[model samples]
Target: MTAGERTGEKKDQCQGTGDINFKDRIASSPCVFTIGVAGDSGSGKTTFTQSIRDIFGEDLVTTITLDDYHLYDREERKVRQITPLHPEANRLDQLEHDLVELKEGHTIEKPVYNHATGRFDPPIRFSPGKILILEGLHTLFTPTLREHLDFTLFVEPDPEVKIEWKIRRDINKRGYTREQVMAELGPREEDYQRFIAPQQQYADVVVRVRFSKYGRERGTQDKVYQVSLSQNKITQSIEDVDLSIDLFSLLSLSDRNFLIEFSHEQRNTERSGELIFDGELSARMVERLEQSIEDQTQVRPISVFHNRGHVTATEVVQLILAWRIIHQRVFLERCHHLDQIQG
Candidate 1:
């Protein structure tokens, strides 16, 4: 299917009453829940955020596309020999300013970047609400910007895999030719390494989607691999393998069964293990890692999310469970022993 068609299908599947409960929870939270999903183009950032919007409804959730903060138009960027993926290519200061405003509970006019024409579109006015999902290439890169968010996420699929997805997406949805995509990809790669990849260090969650082993063994190229990273002292390799296994195993189940189980259990569950069988290990490891890192650095770690767009309501519940596990673990780890003792 074409990219737009694929997106539409996912959207259709995502519509249900289950999201109402999720939205109600966000509504009751004291502070707005801000999530940033950063990754290369076509890494499913937009799709993921859209699913969240579908859950919360556009009225309760406002999404700010970091692509809108580009410092130059595509043609201008090319003329200046500037790689669009480079940090210099974006208006980092403006993004920081806007995020700060949002954190302070104010609304701001946001910029719009048009991929079709490769330029900034008209500025759009947005009001801050219960949850804001900020997404794009460099959403989590800057320290100032990262500080304003409640959750920071990085989505890095394998290079070859992402590129192929990009080719298919742009050609089918955006009406680009193969040669056009190839031209864009060449310069973008340099920018990605220098500007984009470094942001992964700041992510509370890193999701790496790889092709399934069965698919690989059968020479199928359509498999996806996802790995999540948090500020825990644990190494990336360990987290990647564990998160990948947990997510992939979850994805393997039929969506119908996943939803039925999630809806029946979410409201009553608190412990991480109650939500998913294998999530407990991932949660404990993350807690230990966060404790080690904070003890050494004296700075609290950020929370990140790997948003896979629209699965069954059960899948959404599982995703939220994983997030809460990571968030609670890190939060507890950051507190001083004195505070715990006093409590």
Candidate 2:
């Protein structure tokens, strides 16, 4: 039984970390929305979810990286001749326990993985937020860990794109030479295929990103993307959310060079729908779509696509994916309400 059932009092929705009254109420109960994001490193997982963070703000969203659960430090892994992508290299069992504790609204001293130093730093206390994001290579690798995720996202970038992104990041930020980064790819990709790629089949939403022809012609391929969003059909309808695209408005943007396609198919034996977007869309074009979603669902402005002269396909997909997550949140909320009434 839930704390709410035992107390027999309806739990108020948490406003954020700053709301004292809500915090007090939550202290007596556990209410959290957990989202698991899985992807190979440098696959744009963080870039893709920027809109969700914009909507909920950091105060209400707590993100935990699975890298911290690494069983071996960088040098140790080198000695062991194993990549971080290997399943045996992480503390998966402890990750599961920590997730469960966070779900119950308990604080945990989460370990820190220093990316720059390639070592485990001192652990820090982590408190649950209204929304919890568990992002890493193995979030969906184990069934028990998957069970605690309210929503799952998988990012699959084109192989070339992944390599380019990783090389840039590791070289510029992680202090790796281009040659060293190139050498690591052979073994890393092998490990990624064996241990990480399979998690894509389990995600409710899979985002595939590739270079856009428009960007290639303009020599801005790094700044632009062609993103395809495959959404597993909604599990069940929720009254509070609706997924609708305004075709009329979408078609009216004649000045923008863009492409949008919708199709239905079976992915991994599950029915799913895919929307592909390519080209340089004007900010107004994206706003019209966002407004359409808000008008239909009466949801507040989601604003993942920042107002600019042109919007990239990545930003457009982020808006749509964020909308789906909003729907998931509402559905989970409704289920919680039903449990309260039954109790």
- The candidate maximizing lDDT is 2
Candidate 1 ranges beyond 4 A from true positions: 1-25, 28-30, 47-51, 216-322, 325-343
Can you write out model 2's per-residue Cα lDDT over 165-250, one digit (the tens) per residue? 89988998888899989989999999999999999887888899877866654314337778899876553433333334446656
lDDT of 1 by residue, 1-343 (tens): 1111222333322222211233344465445657778899888676544534543467677777787899999789879988768888889899999888886678788888898888778897877887777888888777787777766667777787688779989998877899989988877888888889878766654555444332432212322232222232221110211222245545565332211111122111221112222111233223333343333223334222234332322233334424433332233222222245657
Clashes in each model (backbone N, CA, C under 3 Å)? Answer: 16, 0
Alpha-carbon RMSD, each predicted model: 14.0, 6.0
Per-residue lDDT value at 207 in model 2: 94
lDDT of 1: 0.55
TM-score of each: 0.62, 0.85
Residue 131 of candidate 1: its Cα lDDT?
72
Model 1, C-alpha of 22: deviation from truth (Å): 7.5
State each model's CA lDDT, in order. 0.55, 0.76
* Candidate 2 clashing pairs, residues 3+ apart or interchain: none
